[model samples]
Target: MYLFLNGEILHKEEAKISPFDHGFLYGMGLFETMRTYSGHPFLLNDHLERLQLGLDTFNIDLDLQKLDISGMIASLSEKNGLQDSYIRLNISAGEGEIGLRTTPYNHPNILLLQKELPPLMPLREKEAVLLKLRRNTPETSVRLKSHHYFNNIAAKREAGDDPGKEGLFLTKEGYIAEGVTSNIFWISDGKLYTPSLETGVLNGITREYIMELAGTLGIPSEAGMYMPESLLKSDEAFFTNSVQEIIPIHTFEGRTFPGKRGRIAQQLYSHYERDAQVLFSKNELHRS
Candidate 1:
């Protein structure tokens, strides 16, 4: 396997970073996980926008425009002989002193890692159980996809190793927050619902896109604080993330849903896949 580090593609074993980097010492780093379809990054512009927002929040000084992102992803993929792969683009505060500082980071480390994945598939169902652990509040006012992930790891431990199961989280106050690795959504009486950012959930890129897709499809969607019983009122439920895309829930709290057979889930996924294909076709045309 090979990865891109500081503008150079290197074998994963040969990659290295400074131990004193604040990103390593104090978890001062941000990352974006996205997928590519037919060599075109799925929503690359949106992901970069979010990443830039996070970099600004963390005082990490890096200009994304100076980097050829698409070229790098294509080159790295070719080096590793992969297509339709998972990509994790990370930017970390470079080497810093032992103690925390409020000063801006002038030198930041950039990395892009890739892993092979099968072609996009939709409606993979999973069972969701409420976790004993509650979602932790973000360190900052708004949540950023940073290196601070222990809270999620603990929730995953509580959820166990069953690949078919996902654990749902509630805020400390017991409002539905999100899935251990994805955002939560449910449909009740043809209306789509999800937990608001007020619940301390990360404003996921795919979560944002899902709401937009719902609006485009004329399905009324709402995001606000709600109780677990809300799921009981819902006929269909699903989770969203960049990599997994849309995951329809088959069962929650002993209530059975149509899962992949769901009308809304099926509709949203068809549109989502179509959008990705449209982008791929545009890239093909541009190349020709």
Candidate 2:
């Protein structure tokens, strides 16, 4: 694998960051996981825009405009020999004094890594257990994909590595939140519903797209806090994330759903695949 560090391409062992970096020391950093379609990044601008917002919120002064992101990705893809790739883009507050005091003036360190995207397995219905660990209020008042991930880590630890199960989280107030790393959605009577962002959801890019897709297809959709009982009664349910898109849920603890890959889920995924090609054409993707 080849990783882009600042301005150079380096092997995994060659990449390095200061131990004192605020991101390393205090979890002051942002990361975006992206997927490349064919030979180019899918929804690159959307991801970057969200990243920019995080940079502004944290007062981290990293300007992405001065850097040629498309070129960097292409160079890395060529070097890594992985045209279809999974990307991890990181920006951390550079080395700073050790303390909790906010250090917004530190230079930002950038790291980009690329790897071959494996063939996606069939989208089977997943089983999820509602964990006792409740999600905390976002440290920044909104989720920003920051490095402060102990809550999620703890939940993941509790869930363990089960191929057939995932951890579902609840808000401190005991409302439906989301899956460990994916946004939760359910369909009832042909209507689509998801936990509102106000419920401490991550505002996933794929989740937003699916909402738009539902509107475009005339599927009734709503986003708001719902009780866990709502999901248990759902006719169909699924989770969404950038890489995997949509994964149907077969059973939530003991309550079982039809898990038949409902019409909404199927159409959204189909359109997502088609939109990727039309939205990211060869000319736009390989602009470098």
Candidate 3:
């Protein structure tokens, strides 16, 4: 695998960051996980735009104009022989002083890594388990994809007992917010219902795409505050993320629901895969 560290390409073992960096000391950093198809990155512009937004919110400016990220990703993919890969982009405040103050640091640490793609859980059937965790609202940290993910980590650990696939999180007010790292959606009476952004969710890229695709496919969908009791009303449920794409939820707290592998989820997954193919075609055209 090849890693791009602060504009230089190097072996993974050769790349390193400082211990005193604010990103390390206080978890004051932002990151994004992306994937590539046929040696081309999917939704590069969207991811970059989100990264820029995070930088602005954190008041950390980087010379993204001179970075040539698309070119870098291409070259790294060719060098690493990566046809399909996972890309992790990270930026942190460079080595700061001992205290919680920003000192004279000219260089912020930038880490871009590309590695072999992991095996995705098969999508022939969708299944998930709901946990008892609630999500934080937008008033907390909705704008930034920061590194403070311990809450999600804790929730996952607590959910290990359930044998189902993904873990769903309800809002503090008992409305469905999202999964551990994905957006939540359910189908009821031919209509799709997902928690609105007002519920303090992450506004995931996949979630946005799903909404658009649902409209194109004539599947009525809406976003609002959804309660746990609403699951009983749903014909099917699934979670969406950049990597997982879309996965079906089978059980919530040991209670099985209808449409665990229902027709609606299957149709949505088919449309989503078609969209992915379109993305790959666009990337290939750009490369040509």
User: Which 10 consecutive residues of model 1 have the lowest summed lDDT?
Assistant: 279-288
RMSD of 3: 3.6
What tens-digit string does per-residue lDDT give for candidate 3 at 1-288? 678888788998898888988888987788888777666676676677778777666667675656788888888888898867888889887787777664333567888888887434355334555567666554355546778787788888966754446677887888877888788888889999998888888877777777877776788999998787887667788787777667777666555655436788888776555555445322233232
Give the residue spans of candidate 2 off by over 4 A: 101-103, 119-121, 278-288
lDDT of 2 by residue, 1-288 (tens): 779998899999999998998888877889898777767677777778788899888788877877888788889998998877788899998888778755464588889988787634346677878999998778766789889888889999998888677799999888899888889999999999999989877888778777877777788999998889889888889988877767888888788776645776777777777665444322232231
Candidate 3 residue runs with Cα over 4 Å from true position? 63-66, 102-106, 118-126, 137-143, 161-164, 254-260, 280-288
| TM-score of structure candidate 2 | 0.92
Model 2 lowest lDDT segment of ten: 279-288
Whole-model Cα lDDT of every candidate shown, in order: 0.89, 0.81, 0.73
Alpha carbon lDDT at 27, candidate 3: 79
For lDDT, the strongest prediction is 1
Cand. 3 Cα-lDDT: 0.73
Record all residue pairs in model 1 with backbone atoms less than 3 Å apart, i.e. clashing: none
Q: Is candidate 1 or candidate 2 better by TM-score?
A: 1
TM-score of each: 0.95, 0.92, 0.87
TM-score of candidate 1 against the unseen true structure:
0.95
Task: Indicate whether candidate 1 or candidate 2 has the larger lDDT.
Answer: 1
Better of 1 and 3 by TM-score: 1
